[model samples]
Structure formats: structure tokens, C-alpha cells
Target: MTTEAETLARTVLSVENLSAWYAESKVLHGISFDVREGELLTLIGRNGAGKTTTLRSIMGIVKKRTGSITFNGDQLIGRRIYEIARKGIGYCPEERAIFSSLSVKENLTLPPVLQSGGMGDEELLEAFPNLRSRASSQGTKLSGGEQQMLAIARILRTGSRFLLLDEPSEGLAPVVVKEIGELILRLKARGFTIILVEQNLRFAKRVADRHVVVENGKVVDILSAAQLDSDMERVQSYLGV
Candidate 1:
């Protein structure tokens, strides 16, 4: 009984009653949300509010998790980390996690392509011109911005349709942050869906289509960009900004 419009507007990812823990301490408490295909959604909150934990749980990185995480109609809760990844979800942790020992080229080419339609090395280099210049340099030798760029660009080669980016703009120079923002916009234009964990509200406002506010390990609010603009006072109160 699904209408054509509803089918066209189907969610690419869905999480319901999702809870996670580190050892014995529960971090996320029944967090739930949906991400439409090609939408840019952001998780924003004060420190230790479980924004990153949600992303990790979605990627199966946080093994001690409960509830449902479905992607394109497939259940992901019990899947292995690699199994989940091969289902076309790419993760860029807050740490960037570039291989310190590998050259930029090597790091960029390392991940095996998990699906069709991934960008080739040349295409990725063209998209991130600075990476082309640092091709021969070790990952550790790159600037903070370049390292973050490498972290994101490396995943594009995997043909991932969904991207979980954790604090991508954290600790970067303003100019570098602007560049990363532009890059994200570009990726969105190419029909990629993204879930971002951003501490910089200003930056998130510029790139995200919608915002999900998390507090005390739960999704406390969901707002469209327009709603956020009009209700920023309430949003700021929730974020304790």
C-alpha cells in the first residue's frame, strides 16, 4: 500500500530504541532517528552528550548495543563491523585515523572498494587538490586539514552511499574548516547521504539539512534548518550554549 511518493521518499537509514554502552556504563538511551536518502543530517550537543557514540553504534563499532539499526531494508544490529561496512556505510572517526606510516597515496588507495561507483584515485585527487600535492608525504606529515581531508577522501573510494563523519571540523583553523565545509557541500550535491557530528553550530547550520539534538544520551529534539533558525533560543538552551 506504499504510494509512489512515499517510495521515492524512503529512508536510507533508520534507528529505533538504540542504546549503547562502554563496558558497564550506558551511553545512548533509546536514541532513534531516520535519514532520508541524500539528506545531510547533523547530531549536535554539548560535550559527552553521546553524539559520537550514536555514529559508532550505527557503524557497529560499539559492539555492546541494542535495538534496531536498519539500512536500505537490511538489519545491521548483529552484523560484524566489516559486514556493516560492506553494506555501503563509511565512517570517518573524530581522530581522522590516517595511517601514520603510509604515504598519502597509499592511505588513499588502501581500502578495498566495497561497491560500484566509487571515485577513482585520479578523481579523488582532483576533488582534493591538496591531496595530490601531498601524494608522496607520510600521513603524519600532512597538515591537520590535509589529514582530515585524507580521512574523508579515503572512504570515497569505497563506494559508500552513507557517511558517518565525527567532528570533522574539530580543532582546525578557520580557513581549513571553511574548506572542509565546502567539500561536504560538494559531496551532498553528488547524492551522498551524510550524518555529521559537529560541535560547531555555525558550521553545522551551513551544511546540514536537519539537526538532531542529543542530550543525556538520548535524541531530545529534531529540527529542520528553518525550524532551527527560528527556534535557536530553545536549541541553544538544549545545547547549553
Candidate 2:
């Protein structure tokens, strides 16, 4: 059952006219979007188009950022990174950072105990059965796709309501990609709100409820899944995918 906190959720994550800089270099211009309850939103664009930076800014990892970012009705402009995480936002970067020396179970349990309503290892194992099989293996021993699955699954232990996933389909075999796509859909069906940053149009087309196209550091268009299903050419021209 979806709680009032999840429903009437209006917007779990909202960014308005956001901008960011690394030292003197401006990376993101004024970009804005919203992730509603249980929605699977995605950001797509070319390399260097500021997709990753946008996620980093939302997580408060950027050196400097400006504009209004609100999570669950609280202003996030000046919050620390962990503070933001505590507000129920989990981020998985493109690199899939895992502890190479630790076993899969250990890596999953390493994060600070969360205070919100995300998934646990047992539940995540049910969501990704392959993870259950590899639970005792060292992180380095897993294949690339397994590592990616572990990385995203581990973030669930943080108890986040909103997940920001970066290029989750990158560099995986088609079979692995298909599995990842299914994991994302199952997450959505379970009422987890996700904002995925993807370059793979096929993967995004499968999972996204809505699509936001970013170009030259700004969101240029917003399209529904229905729109994408009806017209791939329009989306492809914006993304060159």
C-alpha cells in the first residue's frame, strides 16, 4: 500500500532553474524537472551534455550549485550530501562503485543505516535473483553486469524513496541489459520513484514513464512514454540515438 507520504506525494523531487559550476567552469545552466510519486523518469543526451552533473548537483556533490532544489517540500539548496540522502534520495553513478575487496553481502551492508523506506538485502535479492546466487562472492569476482546490479541493489539499503540512476545500461551484454531493464520495471511496480540518466534509447524506451531531453546543459524537451512509443524519430533526433 502506498502511504500518504508516498501518495499525495505531488513531487518527491523537484528542481527549478538549477545551475552548477566546478570552480570557474559552468557545467549546468538553468535546468528544471519533477519526479512524481511512482514515476520512472529519465534524462537522455549526448556526452558532455551535463546529465551526470545534473544528478551530482541534486545529490549535493557538486562544488557549487544555484537554484531551487526541493525534496519532500524541504529546500535542499544548502543541505549536505548525507543530509540529502537521509531525505530519501539514493544515487547510483555510472561507474558502479563497489568495494572490490568485500564480499557482495558486505558491500550491501556497508552504508550507514537509513531512516526512510527503501528495500533491504533480502527484498533486493528477491528482486534480483542473480544477486542471491552471488551474495558470498567478492565484488571484484562478479561480472560487469553483476557488479552493476549489486551497486544499484546496495543503494536500496539506504531506504531511499527516490533513486537517481546514472547510465545503468552502459557497457553490458544485451541479456544483462534486458535483466537490468526488468529490475527497473519491477522497482517501479513496487512504487519506487526513479530518475534514470540513460544514453541507451532502447533501455529508456522500455522503462521510462516520461523522458526529459538535455542538450547544451539545459532540458530542451519533455515527452511522455506514449509520445516516445508513437514517435521514435523525434526523440532520436534530439538524442542521435
Candidate 3:
């Protein structure tokens, strides 16, 4: 039997009737979901299905949105992006926007205040040993996989509880994709809540416990990983994978 405290602590994020628009062009259409603490939830969709927009809206980056978004029991609506981030939310965009000229260490060192107690290098290094080898290398000097690893590693360093990872598996080799999948599971084991947006079905299945499918900017379906696998046709129909 789970205790009341345990049940209460399990919920980390809640999105209720969330909507977004870019200068009168409405994108997301009243999508909603709940992210339980320590669970890896993946938003599976094709391009322009509002996956990235959802992440941005949660981060308060949309500039114009409606409905309720509560993180860790606090109302996220009307909060600034920095304030949202400070409350343990981290957003990794699809572009892998690392400072081209800044070295790995320098990139991680700047914009240092994300969590209350900063994270130690050992924790992130343990997650990705490859990063430690190229710690001194310039951001633009690293390969695609290395850059992706660094992007995530930088987020971890911020001690964020909820990670909005956008397309971490995009444009990486199979081995690197596997490594990222492992990294997601490891992060989940450490009690971090992750909202991963990915088009890679196999990679998403490997880590996501629950699945949310978006179509035409709305959450059309939600299922467990098993349900998604068993009903591949349904997933493929909406995801068009």
C-alpha cells in the first residue's frame, strides 16, 4: 500500500487544457497530461505536431498561452521563463544550442543558477564518461553525439528535477542513440522526471514508461508503453512513423 505522502510526491507536473499561439496562429490545442515523479514520459509525434511547442509552453517561453500549468504544485501560468527554470525545470532545444566558441567546461559554468544546491561534476561525469575526455574541447569541435551528450550533461549540472529533452536522439548513430536511451533510464532511476520529445519510436519505447501521442497540435492519445507496442497500428497512424 502506498502512503499518502508517497502518492502526493509522485506527481511532479500537471498540464490542464494548455493552449498556445504564435501571433494569433494557435499551435497547441488544449493538450493536457500529468508527469509522475521519476517517470520518463515521451511525447511521440511527427514534425510540427506541437511536441516542441508543448515544452516551450511549459517553460513559459511561448509568451502567450492559456489554461493551467502547475509544476510541483505551483502555478506556472504568468511566471517568467527564468522563474520556471529556477523551479527545477530544464529545457534542451532541438538545435543543440551550445555556445560554439565556449569550451565544454565554460559552457557548463555559465548561467550557473538552476537548482538550489548546484550539482557536482562527478555526478554528470559518471553519467557520460565521454564528456570528461573532451571536457576541454570547444563546443563546436565535438561530434554530433558528443554535442548531444554535452547538451544533456549541462542540464544535469543544473540539478533540474524535470527535464524537457527535445529530440535528443535526432541525427545520432544507433550506438549513440542507445547510449542516450540508457542515460534516460539512468536519470529516471535517480528520481528525475523527464519529458522527452522524440520521433524515434524505438528509442522512445526503450525509456518511456507512459506515452502521449500528439496530432495536429492536440494530445489525441495516451497509453502505457505496452499499449503502444501492442497497438503499433494506432501509434503509426497518428505518428506516421
- Model 1 is weakest, by summed lDDT over 10 consecutive residues, at 1-10
Per-residue lDDT tens digits of candidate 1, residues 1-241? 3235434876999999999999999999999999988889999999999999999999999999999999999999989999999999999999999998899999999999999999999999999999998899999899999999999999999999899999999999999999999999999999999999998999999999889999999999988888888898999998788
lDDT score at residue 222, model 3, on the 0-100 scale: 88
lDDT comparing candidate 1 with the true structure: 0.94
Clashing residue pairs in all predictions, respectively, total 0, 1, 0
User: What is the per-residue lDDT of model 3 for residues 1-241, given as tens digits with 9 covering 90 to 100?
Assistant: 3335445756789999999999999999999999888878999898999999999999998989999999989999999999999899988889988999899877766656666654677766766788788889898798998888888888877878889999999999999899888888887887788999989998998898788999888999988877877999989888775
**Cα lDDT for residue 7, model 1?**
48
RMSD per model, one decimal: 2.6, 3.5, 2.6
Q: State the lDDT at 31 in candidate 1.
A: 98
Q: Per-candidate TM vs. native? A: 0.96, 0.92, 0.93
> Candidate 3: global Cα-lDDT?
0.86
Cα shift from native, residue 134, model 1 (Å): 1.0
**What ordering of candidates by lDDT runs from best to worst?**
1, 2, 3
Point to the candidate with the largest TM-score.
1
Task: Give the Å error, residue 23, model 3.
Answer: 1.4
Candidate 3 TM-score, true structure as reference: 0.93
- The candidate scoring highest on lDDT is 1
Distance from true position, residue 165, model 1, in Å?
0.4
lDDT of 2 by residue, 1-241 (tens): 2335434657877899999998999989999998898899999999899999999999999959999999889999899998888888888988898898899888887876576566766777887788788889998789999999999888888888689999999999999999999989988998889999999998999998888999988999888888888888988898776
